[model samples]
Target: MKRIFKLRSELVFSAAISAIIAIIFAIILKEFILGSFLNNSKNTTEYVHDDVIAAIEYQLKNMNINDSNKVQKYMDKENSMLYLISIVHKDGKVIASNNKEIKSIDANEVVDGKKTFKFLNDNRKNLVKITRCDYLKDGCYLYYIYVGYGKLENENIVGIMTGIIFIIIFFLIIWKRISYISEIKSTVRSIAKGNLYERVPLKYKNELRELSEDINYMTSEMEKEDKKRSEFLTNISHDLRTPLTTILGYINMIKNGKYVSKDELNSYVDIMNKKSLYLKNILDDFFQYSKLSSKDIVLEKQKIELNELARQIVQEEEDEFIKNNLTLSINLMQEFIYIYVDPNLFLRAVNNLLSNALKYSKHNTSVEFNISKEKYNNKFYAIISASNIPEEPITDDEIENFFERLYKKDLSRQKEGSGLGLSIVKDIIKLHSGFVKTYKENNRLFFKIYMDIKF
Candidate 1:
């Protein structure tokens, strides 16, 4: 039964059932009020009839039928004493009545040896009481009365009915609102279960609308992340296979003695050695990234001058820079800029940055560096920035993701990198409580490092 209906429809139906039950209860209550009013009216009519009978019996004992003055006094007293009453003659004529139209008694029927009381207004169908009485000697004198009372009034019963109908309409509106929310929740659940395209209908401007928009945003982000993961796996597999294939091909050639010349054999052995080192580098990157991800790398902190550290890293890479025909520039603050950091990890970060600059920069292009101080909110920061002229400028978006594990900006340049150097640099900086960012300006890639000087 639950599966037979859509979630939205099921919610509406349940609400409708609740509304129907409430309406039924309300109707029953209205009927109960009407019934109670009818009963009270009957009681009032009986009490008034008894009073009239006692008055008539007293009049018969104390006054003659011809005494007009005495009868007029009695009529005034009865009018003041009863809720609603009337007197009529057997000739179908009215003598006195609380309501004028009720004065005429129908002669065709009799009740207790008197003419029957009939309702003068045909519209008042639920009149609860009608009583008749005889007082005169010829059975010509009759007392007639009718009374009605209830929660309903002639004018306001329409209003009451209108209110009841409005209640029903309000229930339906609530049901519809709830059903819409239910549908949205169901759609979100479906999306969470791997239906990437599942979406809620934008039917109204309410919480549900905002919720649907949030879900759509989340799903889009998830899809992007999934695509990145897939690409990362494919890139890793390719990197691994290329080195293994080279090593295997070279070993088979050596085993079959395909290189007859001593120089050719040495060259082949060198090639094999380079390919093995490349494979080892890739594996090492994977291990390092995995360790950083799990937060297993611990840092031993020490106070050191950042400018000195930068000079040392540049000196270490001087030979490689010269071999590659790349120009290295170093800028250091005149005063010592001291910071607390792990020296080895900090050097690794600076080294990785310099290595990346070397790998991406064009031959004979100068890589520039600036070591300076930036102040914000009365706090001083040691800022290290490096810029290199690359063969092609990287996009702003790609630069922001430079430190993501196994992320390569240009797949065609896969041979130049293991895609983990920048990631390691980022992790090391984070361990030192520093921040790093990259940007591209005027066809030159810029890397910025920020570290607190005071702490």
Candidate 2:
């Protein structure tokens, strides 16, 4: 059931199986051929030479072979189209023959009473073999057998068997590949039909395994994105509806004449205005974040002094920090670090960090804004960091997903503003080819943006 094996091993296995089947087939066919030849002749020797040699050796043990005519007559009697029989006399004279092509043979070349020789017959070489026999007083009854056709036929049989082996291996491998490809196509089709959980079977340990794993990873990511999109729509709708409901309720109170004093009516109007502004802020953050998150988000990048930009942002938001009873401190390095960035997007990213710090920091505590050039992994980066002590303690898990869209750490979910500010900051920084990270040290949370300054 575990179908994981190397391609090389599979091919070897196919070849092994093909060889076994071909060998069996060759043996069966050889027997059938020898059977047909034997059945055509009148000789009844039972042992079948299912090989290249269809020999019929004559045993003249008691018969007198000194009569050349008698030997010739006997040779002529046993001659068949399947094989030729000739008697080689001791004096190297080929006395009797069925074919007149061979005139004589060297007696010394007949070693141990058997020899294989080649001669030109019809402009082609024909192999002839002498079968083993005894030396008589007149001459030895050498069975000069023409074995060319039998040998060629045997070789052809072997060639046919080898061809069959390769053909079987080719088709077996091709069929497996086609079946696996079909399975992959089917799984992909299912995934395309919104079955994001469907996966290819990983029963094979081959190149396809890597491909399957990659596709499975892609589908998992798409599933996560789909779930996240659904959640985003639900949360945004709720956030939008909450403020609209409050504003509508205030208008209804005024319409129904529920308020007795003008001051109370004015108070309702102020609250409505504040809710409407908060709603607008939420919508703006959502749209901006969505735009930056899109693939088409383009940045108009230019070289600027990063330290100067940090100072300008701090100065712009200094009044807000003071009004919120928080001290804003700037710590910039002496050297002016310059980096390529989209100025508006970069400012937005820095403003979100400052806003988050202002929103969370304990009153009367100082928010530290630092800008410096740093070297990490042999690359120079411009680092902008802000550190502040939060009004409420935060856990490591909360900080881990701090930049995720609509992920609010406030357990009561009563916090003002949509939770997309930090997420937008992350997207803007990414568009500029930078990264943001937040960590806690000395009981103060630190949010840092690292942008490559070397370029």
Candidate 3:
């Protein structure tokens, strides 16, 4: 709610600033530029007034025409704007006005010291000026000019209406856009509150639209990563607790003298030892995974004979096969296949595959460890395939899941192993810019390693 309020505040602030600027600009146009044009029009009209006054005075003095009709016609012939000319007596009597529609005013309006050259009435309905004739005095005749301008009034009405319409539209758009920003703020707040499934819908375009897309993508990835972390913690607690519980139970029984004989006590000790070993192995694998997961992991690389490494790993794991009553068979190309690799990391991956082959290989069946070289994409790679006929039925999905952390093909964990082995193998191979593949061929599950051979 606070975030929404903040967004609204910012939006309103920006809009207010824009509105103020627009008003200032409009006021400048109205007060300075447009006002100056109106003043210029008024000045030109006054010039016409002076010319008419001069002509009338000339007629009264030289032509000596006392007839008001002749004087009105004389002013009309010289006036192109058709201004209303009125001749009046000083005691407030109008002699001649061209149109009665023109607003009336006192004859003293244009007298030298009296409110000279102003509008006739309070409503600004007419521009009027009165002049006293000097040629005929005996209660002197007063001449008045009244200009009723419709164009200026119409322009003012149009300007006022346009300003009102512009203000209404600007505020309407601001209201709509502020509502959209509030929607974004609410979505972000939901995600922060752990509602990971919430998503933003695309409504409008611009930088804000692109920002929404980027935010959605980030949250989606964060959700997946958070889920993985939760699962890892759950698995770790269970895996670590099971072994510790077994060791604790056996220690308690031995301390309480629960073993009936020497053999029973010896068996209890053996079981405790195995449980402790299991706990240690789990911790060690987790530590290795944590180390490799860091971005700063650097491998110590060297050139090694790929065939020798594979043969050596097989020899090392021969005892595990013997314990399980499974045989180990190797098929090598007999060529010196030297490749550059981090020997320690490579051996760990090789050991994982060999151990997995022995663990699932059926008794009285043979697990094949083969090493050969292949060329693809104009580069040579040392290919190692560990093939075994498994004791259990493995599907395509299980093969895919094998490399996922804590995934157990045999949920019972009878193999006495953590599920991180194959996943660690995958991470190590990927770090070395290599690839791994698992497939079924000829009723055999084969794990293949493709490592680039340095020229």
Candidate 4:
């Protein structure tokens, strides 16, 4: 047996099925009504024919056998009274028929002690009535009275069957509609219960499909915003703690008068200044991150030669590199690699990368800049990479989390700088429709930036 449908709260699947069943029942009822009407018509026609034949037989009994004009007048009058009636004789001859189509009746076929009565043809194509009577006083003379109406066709049956089939088809359609609605409701309920990934299994591009797609899109957006907010809170808490610790340390030093000598006092003041600057940077990073989250930052995009930009940033940081006794090297191809970007923001991002490299790199290790172009998917990309040998080998997991805001692998090195440098770099790259990633290979920390030239 086929599975029957189930009802659900959200969808009207069962109601739709019931509606279809009702329609089918109504169609069947209509067919039955028409069948009843046809059957009544057939019965009435048979009754009228029987009555006409009986009346003709009574008139014949009262008439004189020798009077031919009286018998003819009675037959003609009976024929005029019923249009479908016909009379036939015992010798297989049609004597008087209102319709010329009817043939003679056989009087040997008896029904209820009568030699002839009403009957249906072999194919039920015609209705017939037969009667037997003695016109003369002697029993040797026999006369057959044959009366026939018209045939009852099967057109009514055909119409009823058609109505039944239509009702079944209509019910099937309603059942399917109800099933679809139930599925939609089930999916919606699942989504309402915090199942952000829930979706309706819709196959067609109809109104239901569009509605399901819109709901899925909305859930995805809400999940993304929720994730960003959680990450923002975690990053803010971690980043703010480092600066506060440094500031508290400096204030403790001043309160204790630990810097008695002039040189010691100057060093303490320098430490305070650095700590204050670090706090200011952290505040700035927070503002920038908020702006990015709110979609407030706009890119001032323009074509820029990456080689020239790298060289200029490198030159600007030459003093710091030297002061830290770091060796820096630049490898640039002769061909100009141009990319559309916000120059100022791009410079800041590059500066952040270089600063990170300088701060984390072991003293006297070579920091290398390699600029090149990569072709992929029939599109050109400008790649700027910076790498330096770290004091210790960084782990793969650390590299994966390098761009996460305020994430630090070495907790002891927190005093060196604010931890939002790589986060800012990531935001800037995203703004340019580009990407940034970090990796550790051969005891060297590598940061690669990719910018699409085609966009």
> Per-residue lDDT of 1-455 in model 3, one digit per residue for the tens?
11223444655675676566657656665566435544445554546556565566555545334576665565455453544555555555654445544434465453432323433464553344333333244444445444554234534654675577557656775776667778889999999998988887765555556677887998898798788788778777778888889899999999999988999999999999988887887887887788889868889999998778877887788887888899899899867887788999889888888888877888889999999887868877889889999998889999998888777788765667777889898998999989999999878999998988766
Q: After superposition, how far is residue 455 of candidate 1 from its true place, in Å?
A: 5.2
Clashes of 1: 0
How accurate locally, in lDDT, is each candidate?
Answer: 0.70, 0.74, 0.71, 0.67
Instruction: Give stretches of model 3 more than 4 Å off.
Output: 1-182, 202-221, 260-262, 412-415
Top-down TM-score ranking: 2, 1, 3, 4
TM-score, per-candidate, Cα-based = 0.65, 0.68, 0.63, 0.57
Tens-digit lDDT string for candidate 1 (98-191): 4544546665533444422332354653444455565554444645554443224533553465457656765666767678878988987897
Off by over 4 Å in 4: 1-83, 86-104, 109-181, 188-193, 197-228, 241-276, 289-298, 319-326, 333-339, 359-364, 373-381, 390-427, 430-441, 451-455
In model 2, the worst 10-residue window by lDDT is 41-50
Question: Model 1 Cα displacement at 343 (Å)?
Answer: 3.7
Across residues 316-383, which tens digit of lDDT does each residue of candidate 4 receive?
88888889999888999898888889888888788888988988889888899889987756877799
Q: Sort the candidates on lDDT, descending order.
A: 2, 3, 1, 4
Global Cα lDDT for candidate 2:
0.74
396, model 2: CA deviation in Å?
3.6
Q: After superposition, which runs of candidate 1 have C-alpha atoms over 4 Å from their true positions?
A: 1-168, 295-299, 376-378, 395-406, 427-431
| Model 2 spans with C-alpha error above 4 angstroms | 1-161, 169-181, 322-325, 362-364, 391-393
Better of 1 and 2 by lDDT: 2
Model 2, position 343: C-alpha lDDT score: 86
